[model samples]
Target: MEITNDLNSTFSPYSTTNVNATAAPNCTDWPHVPMTTLIPAIYSVICVLGIVANALAVCVLAHSSASRRTVANTFMLNLCVSDLLFLLSLPLWAVYYSQGYNWPFGNIACKVCGALHNLNLYASIFFITSMSADRYLAIVHPLQSQSARDPKRARLTCILVWVLAFACSVPTFYLRSTQHVEALGVEACAIHYTSDTWFYTLTWLKIILAFLLPLLVISCCYGAIGRHLLAGTGLLRIHPSTNAPSFKSQESCCSKPEKPLTPQQCVNKGSSSSGGRGGGRQLEGRGLERVLWTVAAVVVSFFCCWFPFHCVTFIDLLHGGDPMASCWAQWTIKNLTPLTLCLGFSNSAINPVLYCFIGNHFRGRLGGLCKGLCACLKARGEDHSHQRGSFSTRLSSFSRKLSDLKDLAIAEPSGSA
Candidate 1:
């Protein structure tokens, strides 16, 4: 929403001959559009939808055993949190837009809301890039990944991401304020950069940090992952039985007549037998395939959603032209902007869905939970209603088991550490 204004202002310099005092500093003319009908409805719908979807995603990720402590899931959770915070400001925007850009809320609210909006932009990009980096490490440098895969390290990384995201957003607080226009009844809250130099500099910085850099990182990571997966799969086909002997020998050694082997010796023997030359490659390859596919889906979704919005904005900036000159084009672009932004926002909500659908273990556990819940409900409805206590007990037990499974899912693998 904030970016919409930015895009308009950026392109306004070349569009209008008359300046409307009611509009923000950079905007040339306030198009006399009645916000009462349009802006409120649009903002309200987006706010409600984004908040509900993101909240549900958070709940699912929190409750599902498959999403708990994983590095990828951790990033997703943080992304959802940021999205929720961003959504908090949307109602305020809706009210302002409904009032024809008048700010009933004070200067501080304006600044805070503006800052939060930008904060989400940077925070989302950072977490997405971090997720990509984690996958890259897991696939491309499996041995080295152990050092960075711990929960503590992952938590620290999230903190660092927040810090950087906040730093990037600081400019919004400084630049955003309510400006009163001479002849208009409305007041606009907008960024008032000291000069064109500062404005364009910040704009380009955002484009680079929040868009271009993340795009590049995701693309490269997924590309490497894809290549590695293909190579690994090819190798796996060539050595499908390479680890079979090791597994057989290990099982035999475990059940054979007693031998005086130390626990460490036994572990070493087991590792030696199971650590077939190609097994690591095959596992790494499969992991890479999963990571690449997920990242590819996310990256493609992001580009599809944001590209049109950014392209139109940048085009106007370059051409020094008026989008409004072409009424149909302006209307089309305006309609498309919200849709694109919505799609982009929906990315936060989709990660948990991807995890649930793509992960075999997660699907099985979720299925079990559903079955348990259904059974518990059915038992409670029986004529022997005194068995309600037993139904409760069963439900509690099932919940506990689900919680334990979730803990296991989030926990770092022993080998990873």
Candidate 2:
């Protein structure tokens, strides 16, 4: 992930040019052109777009009553906030790249921005993991999951997540600083780990902890959910007796009948049908649960986006000591690396869209909005005289009621005697 900037002036302490002929090799032709050109442009666009998208997601989730105040949604909100904070540093990066690695931003900004970026990385992964755990509990252990479903516990869990994310990000603060590369003239705010070993180890660790472990957890949870749903659906199909009459029809038939019937007909046969219909409804709910297993999809997307970037980084670390690599190989790696990393970074902005797709309430709200807009336009054209008067009054009342609701929703509920 580290791209070398303009570093022509200063001689390396280990350089062989002065004394030892083979002590250290020169890396003068390492494909800086593409790294200087394409990578920055791509990252700049991604950073801006990601910030805007994630910010909007936070606002919508915070404001929308349809978004249930669940532990998962709470984590998602925090995740969006983290992403926004991380993106705030991107403009500095854009500036740095535009000036060809000349960083005007001071040392403190470098450390802070670097830390924020890493914090978001850890926070985003952990939140996704938390969400998958929540899903697993809700699906696999519905009866026992009630206690864990409490919002208070969820809040505690989130607090812990933040703490852990911060702890994991502490290294970035220490490792990132303004390096005075004389060749570049201006200082380059870059991650300058003390040793290559430290960098490679941490990089691999991130791949394992943030990417691999979380992916496994999400995949397992969704897999279990899918199996449960399949089993339930199969059970419903096998048990025809459990799919009889609709609940409402059964209840009506159970009431006093005007017409006479046979002795056996005296029994409420409708009740049996109702019970079967109820079971079928439950099976349908299980099917919906299966569809909600998009956590796996999210994890897959994360891997797809990040794996290439990480692989390149690993390759670079292995051969970084070598100073005479082919220009084509270097150029190919440099160009492809940023594209992959940008894809990974895009995950922050995509989660809310996934929520809208998976959540029934969001879909319903969108449908309602479309319907309301059409109604309003139609009413505008026609003489809604009778409708207009009543609708206006009702709308005013609704507005006032909504104002009250907004207050209540924003305010923390107070305990009463």
Candidate 3:
């Protein structure tokens, strides 16, 4: 519940501007409001944007035609669902922060939201790993992997991922407790560890299960996939040759000989390799390269987003309140902690950007998917405008006829008189 629990500054904040000086343990020599407002703002924006974006991703991914379902798409759909569920839990925390770190919600809400916080972390990380693994199998073992790459297997894998993620989270649901802090005079929801033994146990569990294990899996997959992609000779030998990077650099990855091959020899080698593979293999290789590129980028982004937070958490636990630890280190964990949390939380929103906005094919499909939605609204607006225009035209026509009748009646009366 460290993730979902509210932290109150039991230490007094350094007064800034018109803010009141409250003697709280967590408040430092800095204004709490800036940190307060900033964190809530982050949560609020991520909640709203993450919901919309992940919803779009989930809807598009789920509606994939039966003919189009693949291992990657299944993992992506699972990732979208995980992030959407995580985003749903943020509003309550945002409200908690906005109300000055008070837990207005009861124990049940706290545990539910707290469980979701950790669940999002594990589930999103696992799903991304699942996606990378899917690409790995497709690229490295394309022939052998096909039998296992069906939608049924993908669904089963996703089910296991969800089960594993939530299985770890189940403990938090029972472990989290809310208590009134007399100093702050507010209820706070936090994990009440039975002992330092349990605290150490959970920390290790987090490192192994959430961070280290996932990183190892993704790294191995990408490494194998990268070796496979870069294994072949010239770039022109691959399908979609234009998009491929110049393999003149890749030739360096190979051992340099005292004498290089002549133009004819090089061309023959390229031609031989190209001709050896069928067109289907070339197409598959090209698809393999595309997935490798996207998933590699995703893997890097995932590391960059979550690493800082985990590093901080590791330090906080490893030191275990050592006297040798400097005030600066403590301050770092204090000040940067919330920011790092925000950064990690930002990952929930970023997958849709990576999967839908940045990847070319997915982006195009998402655009096509949303286009009809936008068009529906546009047509409705046009219909309403046309109706208003016709009503105005009729109203003016009626007014003009009435004026003409009045004029005729007056003229006729005068002429008769």
Best by TM-score: 3
Worst 10 residues of 2 by lDDT: 12-21
**Model 3, runs deviating above 4 Å:** 1-34, 233-295, 321-326, 381-417
Compose the digit string of candidate 1's lDDT tens values, residues 209-246: 87888988988876876676766442122122344432
Query: lDDT per residue, candidate 3, 1-417, as tens digits?
Result: 121122432111100001122322342564433565877899898888899989988777777566446667777788888898888988887777676657788989988887888888899999888877776665566445656766798889999999998998887777775667665676766666555565677667777888888999989987876677677631223433333222222233233487676532332222111111111133246655664566577778888888887787686676553434555555655566667778888898888887666554456567887897899999999999999999999999999999999999989978998
What lDDT does model 1 reach?
0.58
Quote each prediction's TM-score: 0.64, 0.65, 0.72
Clashes found in each candidate (C-alpha, N, C closer than 3 A) = 2, 3, 10
List the candidate 2 regions with Cα displacement exceeding 4 Å: 1-33, 64-67, 232-296, 320-335, 363-417
Q: What C-alpha lDDT do the candidate models reach, one value each? A: 0.58, 0.58, 0.65
Q: Rank the candidates by TM-score, best first.
A: 3, 2, 1
